[model samples]
Target chain A: MARSTYTLTIPSSTRFLEDARQFVETHAQEAEFADTAVEQFKIAVDEACTNIIEHAYKGNEDHHIDITIIIDTDRFTVRIRDEGESFDPTSYKEPNLMELAKKRRAGGFGVHIMRRLMDRVEYRTRGNVNEVRLTKFRNAEHRRNGDQA
Target chain B: MSNFSVGFRSSNSIKVLDLQGELDAHTASELEAAIQKCQDEQHYHIIVNGRNLQYISSAGLGVFMAYIEEVREQGGDIKIAALQPKVFNVFDLLGFPMLFDIVETEEEALSKFHDAHEEG
Candidate 1:
């Protein structure tokens, strides 16, 4: 199978999230992913980008977010790079649904949604750049069978 | 930019908000402000009509999460109705149905509100 990659860069602003989402969706479709999987990828990327814009850039519209998506036979990966403050995704705890319902907390749901939709999520900071990568397997059953081989 | 808008109305004492276009992190604040207006007026029984809404991100879902407890605490509830399947999937993915009253039509939501209010 041939490997394919696509890259997009947009200002770190909420206004550009729709464009970003469409970009991811288009590439995911081109890779022949299922419609449901494509939608999950779009949502996962949107949440990741939104967090970079809101938390990393602190809502600064001037910074830029670089997104790269690579599609292979087995899986697809989305890498987001932002020049902003570093954030440790591992340290963030999933909010308790019962407690959140009772408290009605306004934020903290973005990361949870991203984690639930994607198969893998990783975060790292390289000097001034913050990088977040999300991955989804094309065929979970196939991958599981292959792992046994 | 995504074309997003929110309109407000009242039906039988239930506040209804008609949303259109995309609701993401950027456009979520508009919906937030609209909900805030409803809260300020002490209108707790609310129904959000999402039939026209095309897309929604987690941020959009968070807006409802933000206000639900307070609204419920005031002896009212926030019910979502008429959501397109695609839009509803976002909420469903996050287990929103467990936390919200989502129905197939705005009428159902309004009726639910009225029934609860009458019973109480």
Candidate 2:
């Protein structure tokens, strides 16, 4: 008997990470997600938000990103849209750790971690808009008992 | 997706644990359970080799803090080495350098352990 959604718009900066964390934490608590599950959900969402702010905005500090969080009976989904140039996350390949170390790069690990932590991650671009969708199941049964083959 | 992974390897009385992949809230539990299992088995004197670690969130740091406290209570020590710059930045920002003994290489950690042993 749950059908509620919350919306939040904030600057594309790491300073907004607290707001994004609160958004996920609130919905997960409402959905009765286990504390561990809620934690993962928050971490993943924060990474996504950070990615938008850092990569899409390119540290401009002027662009604003819109993030929407929707909570259902068994799942929580966060959708982020930015007015920056279109980009595709699906094309992002997980870099080899050895190579990254050799190059002495500290970035690019954010997207890779997001994909590993979230239940579902999708990216699409349409008409000068870049969108990334993240979804996570709240119920343990839905998560452990769900189809995975 | 575990927050951390620990393995005990003996290189002349120095124990080394290789930590790989992301260490965050989602995966930190696996690390906790694994560490608890090790404690249950009475394995102590730990070194975390983070050569393969890609990212670590605040929750991940919490996991390390909890384990370090437990180890200390039992008269053992925990050390860290090979942290990437970004991951190290997170640790440094959180003031971990003051709380934990962090080294740059596995050999250095072992040498420091030797010094501690001799001093004690």
Candidate 3:
């Protein structure tokens, strides 16, 4: 069962990504997640926010991003909402590594990294807001150890 | 705010950059400027020392992708060395090892440049 929820709101700007990452790291640690898991969540959240700022908002700094983190005993979920352009995340494709290397592509890596780091990633658009939800499950053994500690 | 800074050095003809702190969207431009400075100077042989790089995002990784082709076309390459495991995982996940030469030490990267120069 989900025990608590934390929310943060920040401008749709790249400058706030570090703050967002720190927020996730602190909460993940308090939840007794492993260091590697914390790092993965940090990267995953950062990539998601970056995509919102750069692609969804089209580099507009005046927009805002609302982040909600839900914590359960064995899982962590993050929902990011932005009032930017509506786009289908399912349509986006991870660049082919072989082609990326041959052409030396500079972008299109953010979505790929986000998907790889999180256990589940889903996106939807409701009305004028676009939401991206990411979830990561804690290891069963690790959670049992954390419960004892 | 996340901190990021770059230090430049020269190993003979090779330009070595020591990256410190976080490399994300906010600070990626700083790296881009440093790479531009290298291009302006025509110092194509480049090595990025990531021993002090604590964190990196895709934006930071993009900076390297932006200039690699130009440097390689000029008969030089950008090699990364001493990447902290966390940083390396990001690159490795993206299959960057096949695209760029990532070594265990800065000395190894510098030596590879020397070897390539001698062969050509």
Top candidate (DockQ): 3
How should the candidates be ordered by TM-score, best one leading? 3, 1, 2
Ranking by DockQ: 3, 1, 2
State every prediction's TM-score relative to the real structure: 0.91, 0.57, 0.93
Regions more than 4 Å wrong, model 1: A142-149
The residue-by-residue lDDT of candidate 3 on A1-149, one tens digit each, is 55999999999999999989999899888888888889998998999999999988999999999999899877888899998987687688878766665686778988888877777788889999889988887865443224435
For residue A15, model 2's alpha carbon misses the true position, in angstroms, by 1.6
DockQ for model 2?
0.06
Chain A TM-scores in order: 0.90, 0.86, 0.87
Q: What DockQ, on C-alphas, does every prediction get?
A: 0.68, 0.06, 0.69
Residue pairs clashing in model 3 are none
Q: Candidate 2 — which residues are off by over 4 angstroms?
A: A139-147, B1-120
Predict model 3's lDDT versus the native. Answer: 0.89
Better of 1 and 2 by DockQ: 1
**What lDDT tens digits, residue by residue, belong to model 2 across residues A46-106?**
7777677667887666778787877776678888888876667667876544343344333
Compared with the true structure, model 1 gives a TM-score of: 0.91
Best by TM-score: 3
CA lDDT of each candidate? 0.87, 0.70, 0.89
Candidate 1 chain A lowest-lDDT run of ten: A140-149
